[model samples]
Target: MLEARDMTLTELADQVGITIANLSILKNGRAKAIRFTTLTKLCEVLSCQPGDLLTFDPD
Candidate 1:
């Protein structure tokens, strides 16, 4: 979605009121959890549904 929306991590973080480092952690899939509020902010900024930003992997 970032690619499709032409958004940079810094830009997204700024827009979402999150820190770049924290967003970077999430981007790297190192985050163990995400708050619903954060998810909602991301969806609103990215104009996407939760499914659009996530995937199911049975690793």
Candidate 2:
């Protein structure tokens, strides 16, 4: 989505009010959890739905 939007991680981090490193963790699928507020912010900045940012994977 970031690539599709032509948005860099730095720009997303700044716009979403999160640290770049933290955003990177989320981007790389290393985040253990996410706050609802943070998710809302990311959805807002990315102009996407929650489902668009998440996927269901059977482990």
- C-alpha local distance difference test of each model: 0.91, 0.93
Worst 10 residues of 1 by lDDT: 50-59
Tens digit of lDDT per residue, candidate 2, span 1-59?
99999999999999999999999999988888899999999999999999998776666
- In Å, residue 22's CA in model 1 sits off its true spot by 0.6
Q: After superposition, how far is residue 9 of candidate 1 from its true place, in Å?
A: 0.5
Clashing pairs in 1: none
Which ranges of candidate 1 are over 4 A from the true structure? none
RMSD to native for every prediction? 1.1, 1.0
Q: For residues 1-59, what per-residue lDDT tens digits would candidate 1 score against the true structure?
A: 89999999999999999999999998888888899999999999999999987766767
Q: In terms of TM-score, which candidate is strongest? A: 2
